[model samples]
Target: MKELIVLTFAVPLLMAFLLPTISRVSFTLSKLIAPLVLLALAIMVVCIWNFHTETFVLHIGNFIGPQGIVFYVDRLALLFAFAIFAMTLLMWPWYFEKDESSDTRTRKLSLTLLLVAASAGMSLSGDIFNLYVFYELLAVASYGLIAAGNKKPAGNSYAAAFRYLMISALGSVFALLGIALIYFQTGTLNLAHLSEMKELLNNPAGLIAFVFILLGFGVKAELFPVNSWVPEAYMASSKRVAGLLAGLVSKLAVLVIIKALVLIYPQDEARQLLLFLGIAGVIVGEFSAMKAQDMTRMLSWSSIAQLGLVFIAFSIPGKAGMLAGLAVALHHLISKPAMFLIAERWGGSLQNLKGRAQSSPIMAALLILFALSMVGIPPLPGFWVKFLLLSGLSAQQAWLAIAVVLIMTVVETNYLYRVISSLYSRDEQQSVTSRHRTADTFSALILAGVLIFVSVQVQTVGQALDEIAQDAVDVKSYIDLSLGGGS
Candidate 1:
């Protein structure tokens, strides 16, 4: 089982290398391989779930020595890995169908696989250095995918990708410097060992290291201050790539931030800093999103806000907050991708959705479902996450935090309602009643099915998230499970 954890990261990476060669044989064959890869991953995730008793770790080649890297699989990693697999499955077909250019299509597919591999690597990585490596891998692959379309848009893609790369490089430098400082202080890069030696990091050097790493990971996670690159990048990338970026890549980055907080930082001041930044993110992201008109742009801004909420929940310093963060994280992971897909099909503006529900009711319904989920409507998993967050905030006497959340919620509701209202309105002025209802219906139905499934099974899903959050908070359990020699 431990060895299988390594395979989860390795397989997609291996496939990404081989995909171009396989594409030369037949494009259809290459496309066929993607879902199979996702299926295999999904199967492994299920197997992990069925057999899960505690956290586990695998060093490549079973190399438990100081020289080799380790891949740790806890419920937290598994949960995110499962999300990557499921969203990839949902995304692949649409991406391929829309992308008819063979070269671009092939590159897109390869990048997608690479993105998955990197995300898996980040999730499973037990060391700060390994996390940085995976983060770079994800970033480079995203650059390629964003630029894999028509030359006009590709130029925008290049500019966005370049800016992203530059900012990311700066972040990486900071992270590397931090990692170096930590190693100097503790003589090891293993997160578990670092946690054990937390007392050694009580100095200014360690605090500086923490700040650098937090900024590095926070930028990628779309946290405030450093998140200026996100909307433009999403707006510039092809819709499918946008979906991947929004739904998978950014979430993985945020997950890494959470992991670092849980495993590497045990200081109360650090936790307080995280809380302060998170509250600021919620306010900034929501207010910014409220001003956006383009659907894709709106979603991008909304993602920033949603990430802020996730960070806020995680920063609350308790089991309840961690659990709430996990729930919200998972909910957004599912719904945001679906919303991006809908945006792709329905043009990029809310105005264009006028009479969309009348034309393609199914697509409109799915859009509404995802939008409502984002707004935390009843019986949806998103609602429960908010419920948990509000409950946790009230308990902490954080009235300011509560007020910020309320303001963001109202802003979110207004914008999401605009989309919904446009969809059902009788005004046909902005709509083009097309004969391509089949395509629209098919796309919408798939997303709708997923939204409904997640909604109905919220408790079962929430329990899984709770387990993951518990594993996340249990640092001792993580160390014991990862390095316990399988006895």
Candidate 2:
């Protein structure tokens, strides 16, 4: 099991480098290998989730101290590892235009593999150094993927990528500064060690370090004040790339923040800071989405709002916070990606979508289901997710947050209803000429199926998420498993 945990990241990292060479030999064979490797890793994660429900630690190279690399594997980590592989596999750029070069295809494939490797590593790493390394790798892969999304040489994707690159680089600097401060104070970078020395980080300097780290990571998590890149990047990139960024990568980034919060900086000031930013993010995202003219940008802004909701849930503290955050994160994971897939064919000015349902009824129905789920209609997973969040906020007496969330839901429903109305309008002069690709629709259906299945089993899923939350917040268990009694 330990070896498998290592293999989750290691194998993909190795395969990413080897893929170009493999393509030199047989292009077809190279294509087969990436998905095969991802499938194997996904299966491994599922098995671990079933059989090794207990939390464990892997010390790479049998190195047992703060000097060595460590991977802490709990059910929460395993679930995210599985999501990285599964989502990457689903969003893999399998289709290319007839004029598209073989080199472009290979480059995209290699970068996707690198992204999977980095995302998995970020989820499992037990030390700050490796997390930073993985985070940088994730950023590089994302930049390349976004820049390569559009086929035209002078496409707007480059401008979007450049903007994203600048913001991400700045964030990286802040994160590094935070890590240096941490190391300067503790002489150690291991998370378990940091948790044991929380008092040392409870001071003002330590608080500053936490803030720097949060803002750094917040760039990718779509946290406010650093998320200006979201709409531009999503609009410029392909639907698949946008979906991957929104549904998978952002959640992993949030995982990094939550891990830090639970392990190193369990303080009210930290939580409150997160809450304030989350509220601003929700306000900005929902209103901007409501005003968006295009489907792609609207979904992008909606993603930002959903992540804001995620941050809000996590800010509540303890198991309730964890449970609510997980529910919102996972639910958004399913619905947002599927919406992006639908937008593959339906993209453009909302005015252009008038009467699209007359042409693509199945996709229209799917869109309605997703929008309803996102708006928190009863019996849907999104409803229960919001219920958990509201319950948690109510318990904490966060009346302002409760009010903001409710108001935002109304704002969200208004925008979504407009899109639906456009799709189903009775305009006889509708200009939509293309239907959703069969392959894209099939991929979206799988995610939709998961959403529906979870809806029916909401109770079981909620209980399971609650259990994972309990395990996640058990700080002593994490420290003991990682450091072996801090010996």
Candidate 3:
């Protein structure tokens, strides 16, 4: 199990480097290897489904403590690894099948594989510096992949990529500076060590450090105020890039924030900050999405809104917060990517989707199901998580936040309803060229199946997420596990 844990991420990171060499012998082999490796990873993840609820840390070599880099896996980390690897596999057809631009197809494959590795690494990191390293790696690959494996990019694509790069670069600077400040105080880069230094970190300087780090991650997390880049980037990038960004990358970045909230600073101010920002993000994001002219742009805003919910969910300051956060995060991962892919193949703009449902009724139905789920319709996968959030807030007497959520639910429905109307709208100028492919539709159906799976096993998943959430709030346990039982 431990060896598989090590290989889960390391294989992809190392294989990405080997892909260029592999292409020399057979690009065909190299391309196939990506999915095969991912499939193996997916299998490994399922095999280890019953990973010990207690946190497990794997130190590299003889290194230990502040001097050593350690990779840690908890249930949350496993869940993250599982979601990312599986979704990338489900969406494999969309990414690899159509792009025949490279004879070897090594560059995009390498970038995609590395992106997966980086996401996994970040999730499993126990060292602050190591987390930052993985983050930078994720950022770089994301920028490259935004080009969609093309040397000659499409309109505004380079600009979108550049915007993402610029924002992330700035975020990196803030993160490094915060890291420097922490190192100056604690003289250690390990999360466990730093987590135990909450006394020192509770002061104004510590609060500043938290702000810097959060803002740095905020760029990638698509948090409000720092989320201006979402529409442009998702709109300009390919369907795969948009889906990846909206689905997995942003979630991992938010995971960093959640871990920070748990292990470093779950104080009143921090929780309030999270809640305020979260509510603000939801309101702002939904309004923006409501105003969007293009489906990609609208979905981009929705991702921001959904991430805001994740933030609010985890901000509940205890076990409930963590559980709600997990449910929301998982639901978004399963649902949003399919929508982005559908939009890519079916319609870019709402108007373009007129009579689209008539053309591919199955896909249209899938789209409607996903949209309804996202809007928090009853008995759907999305509603349960939001219900968890509302329950948590009600217990806390956070009436304002509750109001915001309820109001936004209606607003979400209205915009999604608009898209549905567009789909059903009559098109006099319909062209036969606009058609849906089975391969593309099949991947989305797999995602839909996952949603049903989530719905069916909600009770089981809910309990598991609740346990993980409890684990998050149990900061003492994380500290002990990370620092080898406090020496």
Candidate 4:
């Protein structure tokens, strides 16, 4: 079971390596490998779902902690890994839907596979430096994936991709500086080791490093101010590519940031900084998304806003905050991808929704279901998840931020409902585009089905998340488990 963790990521990476050669021999074989790899990885992650009862580290080459790379997998990490593979699997069938030559499709497959491996690796990384390596890996893969959409006749894909790459590269430098500062202070890069260095962390230098790291990852997480790339990148890219960036990459980045927060235990001032960012993100993202003309840009802003709430949820101290963060991340993971899938298949604009219910009822159903879930109506997983986030804030007397999030949620609801309302308008213009049911439709339906499943199993999922949160707060346990059998 432990071995599955390594293989979960390694499989796609292996496929990526062999793909070019295989393409020369059989292009069809290359195109077929990605979905199969993703499907297998999803199965392995599910198999190990209930297997993690303790947080432990897997050292490469049998090397001791802080001396080499180590993989970390607690329930939180496992949950993110599971979500990444699951979402990617759903997007698999639609990947080749766009008509591209064999070589182009094969290259896209390789990069997409690389992104999968990077995301899975990021979730399991046990050291801050190793985590950065995977972070850069994720960024590189994303640049390629985003650029692939540019290969089409028209769009701003290249410009968006270039902006993302430049900004991301600059951000990585800050992150590297932060890692260096931490290493300079503590002489260790292991997260467990960093947890033991409280003296350094609470100091001025440590505080500076914390800021660097947070804002650094902020670029990827689409957190406010740093997330200018969100709309452009999503808008310029293909639906499948947009879905992967918005749904999987950003969420995995959030998980990685959460992991760092758990291990580092930043100062109160730092937490406050993050809390403030959350407030701004929610308000600004919702408002901006509301104003956007296109569904893709609108959903992009909405994603930034929702992730802001995630930041707020996790920023709260102790197990409650951790639990809130998990719920928010999980909820966004389920809903955002489906919404993007809809946007991809059906055009994503206010007008695009017009008469959609009549012209493309099946896709309409998928959009409506996901949109309702996102707005947090009762009995859906989102409602329960959001309840946990606000409850945590209210308990902490974080009233100001709580009020802003709730108010912005209403605005968020309005725009989404506006889109929904347009779906059934009698005078709305009907699109001439043919609505043939394809892999995109099936993939979205599968995601919607998962949302329904989650609604029914809410209690079971909550209990599991609670356990992960508990482990997340117990920094000592992570240290002991990883460094327990010390030299």
Candidate 5:
């Protein structure tokens, strides 16, 4: 299991570097190979799921002591890995069958592989500095992916990517500085060791270190005010890239924040800061999404809002809230990417989708199901997640927060209904193009399947997520797992 844990990440990374060499052999061959890599990842995730392991870690290359830079695999990490693999699997058809430009195809394959490698690395990384390495890899791959299509639009993509780069760089510097501070104080970069030294982090320097790390990671997680780059970036990128950014990359960053919160500052003033920022992000992201004109931009804003909910879940400081957070994270992980993919096929403008459902009921139904899931409709996995989160808030008697969430639910429903109505409305006579049939049908079927799967297994998956969430909040467990039983 440990060997597989290392290979799961290693294979994709090794493939990322080997891709250039593979491409030189033949573009067609490279295209074929890309999906094969994702397939391997998917199989590995299934194996892990069946095995149902608790937590495992592997030290790669052993550059330092016995506990050198490590890749940790736990249920939470595995959950994210599963999401990454699934997204990659769904995205494979776009490259395999779509009529994308040659440049777009090449860039897509390369960036996709890079994104996978980065995400796998982020999920598995057990050290803060190693997390930084993967985060930078994700950012750079995103820049290239965003700029890969439509030369004219590439300018906007480049601008957005550059903005994202600058902000991400600032965050990275803060995080690195915090790591340095931690090292200075505790003399260890291992997350497990840092967690054991929580008493040592009670001073002013430690507080400053926590704040810096929070702000830095908050930028990537799209927390509140630091998330201004998301909408523009999504609008500028191709649909596939936008889906990857909104659905996978942003979530990966948030997961890292959760890891840091659990390990370094599980119960302190730092947790309070996370809660406040999370509530702020939810409110701002949802309201802003309600006002968005472009579908891609709207979905991007919605991702920020959903991430806020995840943060809030983590803030509640209990098994229930953690479970809820995991559920919401997983639900959004599946649904948002599906929505972005659909928006891409339908065109960016909300107005363009008018009467689409009349022409293609299957696609229309799929969109409605996913939209409803986003809105937290009953019987959906999202509903269970929201239910758990709201329950947690209610237990704390946070009425104002609950009110805000309820209001956002209404706003979310309204905007999503507007899209659904536009698609199914009978007044318009917009012709459905044949070009979109393959992409739209494939995406719709896959999304519909996922929605159904979640609907049927909500209780089981919710239980699994709850256990994972509990594991996440157990600081001692995380530490022990990361350090191979804490020496």
Candidate 6:
């Protein structure tokens, strides 16, 4: 059963390389292959999670130790794996415009598969070296997807992708340097081994290295200062692609930082840096979003703010931090993508959205639901997400954080209200023209259903999250399972 986990990483990678060639022979088969493979992987993850609730490890080529490739399988890893497949499948470019060529579609599908493979590898890899490798692979795949996203002849997609590449490349350099520092100090890239030598890393150089990796990964996580790529990239990409990046990819990046924090740098200095950055991100993102002129930019800035909250939640040391962060992360995962889907047709200036709700009441209603939840309305999961974060902050005596969060909530509520009002309002002369696509609407509805379901089953979901949090912060178990062969 444990061995099967390798298939999650291996199969997608193998298929990604072979898919473009396969599409040449039979495009229909190519389309079917990706989804079918993802479905199988998702089911396999569920079966594994249901049957074996214990942590495990996989050593590539049966090799062991720091020099060998290792994959640690814990509940936290599996949750990310499941999310990767599920979200990719959801955001798969299933619909095509009249001008979209089969070759274009094939390329997009192939890149998406590569992204999945790389993300799966990142989630499971037990070593920093492999994590860096997979991170770069994911970056390459994203550049392709984003570049190909816009179908318009004069669209700025290529420019956006180029900007993203520059930032990402710079981030990779810092991350590589940080990894070099770690090896220079401790002589091991394996997380398990590094965790055992945390004392050696309890110095300024170590904290600097941590900062490097955080910034490197933070580029994708929409971490402030390194996150200028967020708005342009999202604007240039298709709504689904934008949704995938904001809702899923960012969280995966955060997972990497969380692993490093839990294992190598459990000191107050590192945590404080994270806290300060998180606070800055929340303030900047929320305020910037309020000033955004269009829906896509607003959502982009909003994603940054939401991730800021996740970072803050995780900054609190312990299972409480993990749980609160998980709550916020999972909530954003559900709502943000759905909102982007709704914005597919309603993407331009907010002024143009007047009376949009009159034409598509269902879409309008879905937006209202998502907006209310984002603003932390009662009974919705977003409220509970904030409640968890606030509670954790109060426990930590983080009064400043509490104030920022509360103020940001009010800011978030006000902007979302503006959106909701515009969505429902009717102008005397200027009627909005574009209509929501059926496919996008359906996708949004599916996500809305998930949000509603989670809200209704909040108790059960919270318990499950608590258990996952418990597993996530178990540093010793992570080491034992990875280094001791998960015995």
Task: Show how many residue pairs clash in every candidate, following the order shown.
Answer: 0, 0, 0, 1, 0, 0
Q: Write the residue-wise lDDT of candidate 5 on 149-246 in tens digits.
A: 44454377778778878887888788888878978998887887788887788888988888887777777678886888888777777777777777
- 1 or 3, greater by lDDT: 3
Q: List the global CA lDDT of all models.
A: 0.77, 0.91, 0.83, 0.82, 0.77, 0.91
- Residue 30: error of model 4 in Å? 1.4
Report the candidate with higher lDDT, 5 versus 6: 6
The alpha-carbon RMSD values of the candidates against the true structure, listed in the order shown, are 2.4, 1.3, 2.1, 1.9, 2.5, 1.2
lDDT for model 5, on a 0 to 1 scale? 0.77
Candidate 4 local lDDT, 183-287, one digit each (tens):
999999988888887667788898888878887888889888789888888887777778877778888778767777777855688778889998899998999
Q: Which model is ahead, 2 or 3, in terms of TM-score? A: 2
**For candidate 4, what is the TM-score?**
0.96
lDDT of each residue in 166-277, candidate 2, tens digit only: 9999999999999999888888999998999988989999999999999999999999999999999988888898999999999989998999999999999999999999
Worst 10 residues of 4 by lDDT: 91-100
Model 6 CA deviation exceeding 4 Å by range: 151-155, 430-432, 485-487
> Candidate 1's C-alpha lDDT?
0.77
Candidate 2 CA-lDDT value:
0.91
Cand. 6 TM to true fold: 0.98
lDDT of 3 by residue, 62-126 (tens): 47776888777777888888888987876663345464655435787888898899998988888
Among residues 3 or more apart in sequence or in different chains, the pairs in candidate 5 whose N, CA or C atoms overlap within 3 Å are none
Mark the regions of model 3 whose C-alpha exceeds 4 Å error after superposition: 51-54, 93-104, 149-155, 485-487
Estimate the TM-score of every prediction: 0.93, 0.98, 0.95, 0.96, 0.93, 0.98
lDDT of 5 at 344: 66
